[model samples]
Target chain A: MKNNNKKKIKIPKGSNILEGSRAVALTVANIEPDVVSAYPITPQTHIVEDLAKFKADGKASYEYVRAESEFAAASIVVGASATGVRTYSATSSQGLLLMTEVIFNMAGLRLPIVLTIANRGVSSPITIWNDHQDAMTVRDAGWLMFFAENHQEAVAQHLLAYKLAETLNIPAMVNIDGFILTHSYEPVIIPTKAQIKKYLPKYSPTKGSYLNPKEPMTMGSFARPAYYQEIRQSLQDDLSNSIDLIEKEYKKLQKTLGKDIATKDSSALIEYYGKKKAKTVIVAMGSVVGTIKEVVDENKEVAVLKLKVIRPFPYKQIIKNLKNAKKIIVIEKAISLGNVGPMASELKSALQGKTPAKIYSIIAGLGGRDITKKKINKIININSQDTNKAIFIS
Target chain B: MKEIRVHGRGGQGVVTASEIIAISAFKDGFFSQAFPSFGVERTGAPIEAFARIDTNFIRTREQIYNPDIVIILDASLLGSEAVKSGVNNNTKILINTTLNPQEIIKKYPNLKNKQNSLLTIDATGIALKILGKNLANTVILGALAKQTEIITLKGLKQAISEKFSEKNQEIVKKNLKAVSIAYDK
Candidate 1:
């Protein structure tokens, strides 16, 4: 009756059995960071606590900084990364929104910091379910963004985010469902230190200076109007350039792990499932994409496309992926207030001056709201029964 | 598909109960999915957790508007919004109270049909007599095992043992006793 299963079974060929938060923790720990920081909040708390325990219990050799507020949390991570050491931290809803100012500041300096976001509902009604608003607000922060469809992707993307961020010199935000994925238990195939070390190349920034005191340089000098334009352009360039590096890392991962079944397509920007038959595809981001895939697969006509990489927008790839379709269902977990969902609106602009497939914007999940399987079926049912309505299931 | 809906407040272990059942199913090689539906409601506020086990894929996402089995962790929730939302001739009602099946069928008119079965057991009493707290989850779980052949006593015992430690083995044994008592009494 006693659990004697603690010999650390090296779980060869790592299973995607881990929960989202634990996966994020394992990735950050694997990166062998210099500093880890946070102030605990529900959902987000487990991530920091797990990593902190890993650090404090002599499990990981790193500095674990428990700050006072979310503001301090971001600032701490930013300072550590500025010194050219790998930095990691996590936050949610109010905490993420609080750290937004410093979040942009970290990206503006072109710091390759990796942050894990437990997607939670923002305030006004005060609920603790999943939503995409917290990460959506930071979409324009010049950070390479990614969303996970489930626990496995949530864990896998955290590792990929670090690789992408460090390579592109553009920070990345990896968002996941809060309590739905965070506090839930599932089997995870945890990689051994030796295996992860082989896949993840050590952090080596050629240009950035460390705290040597011999070669000191100003990091945050306010540039004059003439120089500001070019600096902003460089940030844009770095973000745009990350698309290739993201795919490169993904390919390397696929090669190392016998290819990704969740994202089998060569380009790792998005994942697709179902009928591969219908021109009508429902595009979405975040955890509910799993439910959407189930519904579409059952219907036997419609297909589900998951937008894994959100920022840098995967513009050309987006147009290419949805090009074959005559009609598209752009379902956004976070709404854009005045009109269509965020991704749909962005795609609309990208695919401007040409209207091949009529896009129906369905903004269903807001402040969590139990966006179950039936609701998605109803949407698809309505789409089949009548495609005229751009539905909003709020 | 065997659809189960557990009705209880936030702290009554409804979700945990559903998960335990699902774990039992998974160990038996059955595909199962278990999830919970909660609101701004805090502890002691009514919450519903669901489980669906099927030989094939289950695409119907509707809240088991009518579940094959309805577990009442707290008898008070029998009057709650969710209880009446989905109860029918095919539904089997398992409550944590002293009232016998016939007495419950008499008290509730909706359960008048011959097809409906009310299986009542003093789950709270069983828990208090064994483990000490008002943990009707284990007792109701026992009643569930009795009312239906979803799992065997040995299989349920192994599931409980897998979930808990050596110290909690007594808890598992007592729970198994609760199941047998509820079924026989």
Candidate 2:
């Protein structure tokens, strides 16, 4: 697609079947961010490229900066956000890893910037595939994290993320499993520019919060050891307390942009599917939850717990939902290198002596490997017999 | 629900064809999902893309194992094992080659004498003649629309126009002509 011929078509007010990246880009354009600086990486490449194209064709009003590196891209967003502008950036895998330092800086400085992580596997053997490793690497960076099951939810999350992040003055990362969700095409109802303007409004920081000419106050100055602990505690406290605000913003977006825009009958943090009293339950995040939900639909005795929010961990919600299950299976795409799956480990810590459900960690679909129905059924079959060991489905 | 798998080389716009199929299905008031299963990141490398059309919402993100319809955009890939991997007797197979159905079966005797419906077209020749290029991905969709009622020609044309509408209108015109020529063939 070249940008030489710039002709606009009137998109009807309904679902437009589009690739996930394109839908997201359109939504971002409607949101009307002040700056979008990103270095392209596969899966994430389409998104930045689309946004760049929009800027080139005069469809987007934001300044699309062609950054030299991911680090520079992250730095650009941070700088723009500090000056009280709604800024956006996106990356995947190694690109994300490169942006780690700036990622934490954005959060610590209390910049309400939104970044999209087209989640991908990390290096070592060098694979360009979908996995949770990249997102999991910065799980505790104090940024509000969200995992979308599909394109619609992804669009909804972006709309809601901006509202919540701006309200709480915190950074956010919306993680879409690379390739799986980013490359897939589906019918998505992106909010119109008018709808977004009415919903998100404009970015106006509180007095003295941003770097303004009238208010001369040092920003991101070195915090001494005396106050650093409390500052960190404040971020932790706000992130944990933002649970209620997230739900509130989610409901607001749903009410503002029809019910179809929201993930059907689910909270902003988690979504439960399949039989409520099923003996076996599978817990996972990202697009894999969709496959598990399909398998659960056929099996009468299995359920699925789709974790949408990973930053807050949602441990209390996870425990509240899985208290009755006889067996719990934690399926994840990323492992903690030497230890168990990050999500499984967190679940065990959260559910210790809390639920009688025997928890099993099953790691599969590493480096873009397909998670088929047969493999899901294999997890079901393995759960029938008791074993505390983690199962890796090859 | 109907599952369609497309087999082609990287630069052949295999992923775009699958997306157009999904868009056409969506245009016809069906829920659809389309995605590609990439191998290597280079042109001419064999790749597979999939499209699923269902009356209900599509939830599964797994690659298609047993597709009801299979499309081959490159005749050179006809000899690959992947082309016939999950094909059953009832599977509808479309190939972009000049060989007729009988000639194709004769060349690849292992296609098994089953009740499978096979259709072939010289997509390359048609694309070269009309579009002045060897991009036959969209041309194959016209044959698919004509032979099978899986997707309507009107819906396919609308989807094609929408896809290429961002590009030069001349390209869209030529591609639409190629599709019509293949449809009439």
Among incorrect, acceptable, medium and high, the docking class of model 2 is: acceptable
DockQ of 1: 0.16
| lDDT, model 2 | 0.87
Question: What does candidate 2's lDDT look like per residue over A1-394, in tens digits?
Answer: 1112343422224888988999888888899999999999987999999999999988888999999999999999998999999999999999999999999998999999999999888899898998888998998889999999999889988988899899998898899988888888888888888988878998888877888888788888998999999999999999888887887888877788777776565589998898977788899998988888889889979999989988777888898888888888999998887777888888989999988778888889999989998999998777435444567898
How much does each candidate deviate at the interface, measured as C-alpha RMSD after superposition?
A: 9.2, 9.8
Best by TM-score: 2
For model 1, how does the per-residue alpha-carbon lDDT over B40-152 read when each residue is reduced to its tens digit? Answer: 23788888877776553333333466688888888777655577566767777778988776676676655556324677789898888877888888667767776776755
Per-model DockQ against the true two-chain complex? 0.16, 0.48
Restricting to chain A, the TM-score for each candidate equals 0.91, 0.94
Question: What is the clash tally of candidate 1?
Answer: 3
Looking at model 1 chain A, report the run of 10 residues with the lowest lDDT sum.
Answer: A1-10
Report lDDT (Cα) of residue A79, candidate 1.
86
Runs in model 1 with CA error above 4 Å? A1-23, A26-32, A53-60, A185-187, A258-267, A381-391, B39-41, B54-66, B87-91, B114-117, B149-185
